[model samples]
Target chain A: MKEFETVTVFDLLIRYIKDGRIRLDRTRFEGLATYHDPCNYGRRAQKRFGHGFFEEPRWILDQCLENWVDLHPCRENQICCGGGGGALTSGYNEERIYYGRRKMEQIHASGARMMVVPCHSCHGQFNNIKAKYGLPDLSVKYLWELVADCLVWP
Target chain B: MTPENSLRISIENLERTRCAQWPHAQDNCLTCAMCSGACPVAGVDDFDPRKIVRLISMGMTDAAADSRWPWICTMCGKCEQICPMGIEIPDIIRRLRAMRARDKVPGILQDGLANALRTGNNLGLPKEDFVFILEDVAAEIAEEPGFEEFTVPIDKEGAALLTTIHNKLVNTHTDDLKHWWKIFHAAGEDWTVASDNWEGTSWGYFTGDDEAMRVMAGRIVENMRRLKIKTLLWPE
Candidate 1:
């Protein structure tokens, strides 16, 4: 719930930024951002009123930056970091690393310093995946958390 | 073997279960530890995913079935993703949860799961009430300054895709409800939340009872059929 709200909050905030009605100093980010789709959310999003997920946090990032950047291998088919489905609990520790190594490669490929995750499961999974697999350092935060942090504080 | 011996064998087999053996296990295959490392609950303090499976294989279910760790496992299958032996640890954890749900419900979590089975939602919230709350939430979203005309679909047939959210997403995290709502609008996509069977979180899957899981799946399928939605994008 907190996870989804992160996205929602991001959306609302972005809308406020672009609303053009609320005047403020706008400084768009000149960096790339990537989104990670959690399977649980994917499991439920497959057929709700004939829709598919594409621009998750990407959409919000787009609202904030013209160069939101591109993650070569985007959502849906994105590699599993081997942490969800109770896998992070320890039944297959060594195997989790083996599988997560693939995801580590992807984040390395993205070359983005920041990865936006809107799902709680994905947040924990990525952090653990990077540490476990020794992937290159990259900042990770909930999509909303990022937006929340960049509120252009008054 | 004599007939008496055969009878003894029959009784032992009858009493045999996944929980009946534990003391005999010396250690696990080094590769099998992947299951434990991949498990989400491993970091949750003493809840070793591999240990749970070891207990299951050894038939040490009494302690496992009673452990609160079963409820904590999200059944995400990361262990299976990395398992070299191809062991379906998530399935094992699911079965354990189901077996335990029968003996005990744990707390409001089980109650919510039961309510979902009985009333099509974790809270057993009435359909009318659910619809009312959904509209109310959406209304609030619309009134939030720039969200004046935000539209969240409800039973809109022939939508290209169906986006899903956990009931907990809307009921508890109302603000979060707008995350996807805003996504849908930004994409210029067509979607709707089902008036019936819209709850996407499958607690039945967690409970380990296949019957309940199927029931939950059946509801979602039926809802899809009703809405004529072809794809389901689940947001757990």
Candidate 2:
């Protein structure tokens, strides 16, 4: 803890791979994957801290998956998954799902089988959208889940 | 009295008292509707960010504040981010949320905030239950193929990482924590979670309570200080 600073799991994973702490078996994942830039870790943090973590998540995705794509209008301009701002827990399920239709459309347009989201709120929202839209082909997963799935043990 | 006439009376009252509170509420807004266009919840429950700004600018504060739309907004700051006028629309929405009486707040948000302030976590989870759940998950993981020695270290001082957890992960989806713990095990990273104030998401940020937010955040800081850990990997 002497020299370590607070960092996101994405940042830590990048460092771990670069510094040879861990090896990722990218060959394990062969599907087309798209990344969702979570508002808290991306745009809002950038606005507040003068730096947004746009690249760290993508870097994680690129390392773990052979085929990775971006959601249209991604990074700083990416749309909210509509479950943020406490809307998921706000007890407005109908309105929350209705609001997430735009995000659902984005996912549909991306044509990727897997959607990689870093935030729990986005995870919940996308899972609901997938259920509501009946898209069993599309799956929502956390960045850590992918990394753990692809870890190359010694 | 017709509906329009009654609305006029409320607008007059708003003009007399609340219009001056937000100095930039008027004149700065160009009524471009960019905020509305960019908002994810713009049309839900007839809530439009542009209309909220316009109504307030035109001394229709009561009409804007009285609606349930303000609570419906996720306050993602996308509208403010996209606003060419730099109107800070989300701030106005937050203020509107604060204006509502505590008991009048929608859903369980108010209760969550109260629980967070009282018990260090939004679900009011006791320290033992939180530890028990983590240990339970760890035991399950220990039986897995690769993780024969897995243990969720609580209060492990000087660990390289100290993490805060989302309440949903602990309360409902306890198995989700196994994903990160698996990663930690695979990477051989040093991380420990505090037995107290392990909540990561700030419900106070949602409920528009500054004091509640400070207390919730302060618990994390207090944990870090108590544990003497420097690096935090809070993902929420």
Interface RMSD of each: 9.8, 1.8
lDDT of 1 by residue, B22-122 (tens): 22233233545877765544755477777776655444555677776665565555566567765656556666666673637544446666777888887
Which candidate number would show the highest DockQ if scored against the true structure? 2
Candidate 1: which stretches are off by over 4 Å?
A1-115, A120-154, B1-46, B72-84, B101-103, B141-149, B157-161
* Tens-place lDDT digits, model 1, residues A89-126: 33445555555665667777776667777665566668
| Candidate 2 segments whose C-alpha is farther than 4 A from its true place | A1-4, B1-23
Q: Give fnat for candidate 2.
A: 0.74
Each model's C-alpha lDDT?
A: 0.59, 0.82
Most TM-score-accurate candidate: 2
Candidate closest to the true structure, highest lDDT? 2
Question: What DockQ do you compute for every candidate structure?
Answer: 0.11, 0.68
By summed lDDT, which 10 consecutive residues of candidate 2 chain A come out lowest? A1-10
Whole-model lDDT for model 1 versus the true structure?
Answer: 0.59
Per-residue CA lDDT of candidate 2, range B33-145, in tens?
88888888887778899888877676666566667888788878889898887777777888777777888888899998888878888899999889988999999999988
In candidate 2 chain B, what residue range of length 10 has the lowest lDDT sum?
Answer: B10-19
Over the stretch A1-154, how does candidate 2's per-residue lDDT look in tens digits?
3544678777888888898877888888677789999887888888878888898888888789998889888988988888888888888888888888888888888788899888888898888778787576687898888887888863
Query: TM-score of each model's B chain?
Result: 0.71, 0.88
